[model samples]
Target: MKIYIVGSVGSGKTTLARKVSAKLQVPHFETDNFVWTRHLKGDIRNEIEVRDQLLQDAIILDHWVIEGVHKDWTDPGLQVADQIIFLDFPSQKRVQRIVKRYIYQLLRIEKANYKPTFSMFLRMFKWNKYFEEQMKPEFIMKCNVYDHKLYRFQTDKEVKDWFHQIQRG
Candidate 1:
């Protein structure tokens, strides 16, 4: 089963992807990894050709789970996904989660792909807002034709319920 999970910061995209990957026994990919070359100092954007190729390579796999906030260049993933899970929690909830996650990362209780600096924390809020105000509509429009394969959830329970009965769907 191929799954593409999309959500803004603090919407639990990585957590959900990890869970699904383990349950389905498929390799999991993160769009961030494709977009950036992480370093101790910071992340640098991968070249467009390199980034697109990495994403294409992952989606071509027979079974995989990919997660990210990137929609502009990830239509390929959407097209191949047998299931597209959108974590559509409200903006307020997302902001709260972002704050809590920052706290955990700050305390070293949770590991992040990038350093959890205050600047990055602030950017998360901005990214979350951009997602709601700008990207959400476009994303929904793109997924409209995939209604048969799309699952949108506003709460944690709703996502859990869908996952438990995923095969049945």
Candidate 2:
């Protein structure tokens, strides 16, 4: 039951992955953990060796979930996944979520690999631009090419119901 969850920034990919993974009692892999450098301001590590090792390990496991918005790092995981979950919410909703989450993280002193800096929000505000320029045409194209069984969810309740259905079935 390998699952690969892909979504836009602040669409709750990590939250959903963690919940679903726990429900299914499977290992959960966050793409940030795969590509992030230990140092705070270092470059993202997308080396073949690092990602390859993670993919190899995940393949050997019977059940695992990988979640992220990274296309290059996620491509290898997608190859081995039995299910794909795409969270495509409204741009406005996504922006609200991002802003709220960013505020909460800042208040709590929680660190996110891709922190919500002012510059990031400025770029993210152009919702159509993000989908058009980054995620939709490129990352989604690859997913379509592979013919992955993708589950698209719009609302939080729908996502929960889908997980329950998966659990019961």
Index of the highest-lDDT prediction:
1
Q: Where does model 2 exceed 4 Å of error? A: 40-46, 109-128, 145-148
User: Which is the leading candidate under TM-score?
Assistant: 1
Would you list the C-alpha lDDT of every candidate in the order shown?
0.92, 0.77
lDDT by residue (tens digit), candidate 1, 54-87 = 9999999999999998977999999989989999
Candidate 1 achieves a global lDDT of 0.92
Candidate 1 TM-score over all chains jointly: 0.95
What RMSD value applies to candidate 2? 2.8
The digit string of per-residue lDDT tens for model 2 on 32-61 reads: 677665566655776868876876677678
